[model samples]
Target: MVDLYTHILPNVEKGPRDVNAFLTMAKSLVDQGVKNVVASPTYNGQDLEKQNIMLYVEAANKHLQHAFIPLTILPGQKVTIHYRLIQAFEQNVHLPINHSTKYMFLQLPNENTDVLNEQILYELQLKGIVPIINEPERHPTFLEDSDLLYEIVKRGAIVQLSSDSIVGKNGRKEKKAALTFIDKGLAHIIASGVCADTYESYTLPKAYDMVSRQFGTQILYKFMENADYIVEGKAIFKEQPERVKKGKFLGIF
Candidate 1:
């Protein structure tokens, strides 16, 4: 499986402290059935940070080869939201998901998404870049009113739910939001946003089990297929997003 969001790179962002730590994390992911991991360290539009992450990816891949590990680490960045996001992409500072340049893992602020966020997503789409919002379930704004998420998805943005969120690692609110996203067909992919520190509780197998139990196997397959689409830089399959009807919040159960 393709675990699209990870901080497995050594000494980059809040990931593993050293190469040894990164290798351990990679081994754990491989053990959890992850074959392709996108090394998405956080990027705030800094050139130095981007360079450092690339270096870490190169070093990590070399070690994987030496260790004969079957895991393949791909280059990516979890870009923080900013008004000049389109400009960063134009300047080639922002690394897209798997270096595809067509799909990017974008982080939205916890606050309510305003016109500016929509504008950035619109501009990114204009340039052939699809912004996949990372873990919207954890954001307060989304938890407050899920219709906002449907709006974003309607405007050509994809929503990526964290694997841990589905399994209740993030808490009750996030879990509810995640399940709601699946029920409403707003979530396109489920990624193991496993960092170096949180592997035991956030395993991909557990996440899949939780999703299958709650949403069924067909929804699980859609998420897995979407991950492959992202890796291939192709458009993901998105069902028409529907808002949660009043008094139907418990329908997922």
Candidate 2:
């Protein structure tokens, strides 16, 4: 399986501190049946972080070769959303997923959807890059305004659900939101947003099981296939998202 979102790059962002820490995390991922991992360190309009992540990927894969683990690390960045996003991409300041320039992993603010600039996303799409919103299920604004995600997806963006959220590792509310995204068909990808310190490495498999049990094996298959497609830099298949009703209970607008 391909893990599209992860912070496993050593000494970069909030990922592992050293090579040893990264190796430990990598072993955990291998144990969880992850054959490919996209080393997506946080990138907020910076080039140095992306360089560091690449350096680490090169080193990590070399070490994994001797470790006999059948895993390959790829380049990616979980870029923070900003109004200058379009300029950053145009200037080649921010890195896209695997440097493919076709898919980007965008990190939205947790507080509200007001910070999201739909035009920037539209501009990226116009340039033939698809912005995959990272962990929208954990954003408070998305919980309060679920239709915001539906509208974004309708406008040619994709939503990536956190594996930890599906397994209730983040919290109950995030779990509910994750399930809601799946039930509504708003989620196109299920990613192991694994951090070496906080998130459990095995949760990705657990999430696949949960999705299979609740949503069916077909949905689970598509979610997993999307990860592979992202790694291959191919077009992803997306189910039509149903519009979420507003004024629902539990602030699920």
TM-score of each: 0.93, 0.91
Model 1 C-alpha lDDT per residue in residues 1-253, reported as the tens digit of each score:
9988887777776688987887887787788788998888776655345556677788889999998888998899888788777777777788887775589888886554588788888888898889999999888877766778888898889999988888887888788878888888889998887876797666577877888888789878888888998988877788889987766653455
What is the C-alpha lDDT profile of model 2 across 1-253, one tens digit per residue?
A: 8889887777777678887777788888887788898888776665455566677788878978887778788988888887788887787766778876488988775444454567778888899989999998888778777878888989888899988898988888888888888888789998877777754546788899999999899998999998888888888889888876664423342
Q: lDDT per prediction?
A: 0.81, 0.81
- State in Å the error of residue 61, model 1: 0.3
Q: Flag clash pairs in model 1.
A: none
Q: How many backbone clashes does every candidate have?
A: 0, 0
Candidate 2: regions farther than 4 A off: 46-49, 110-116, 199-201, 247-253
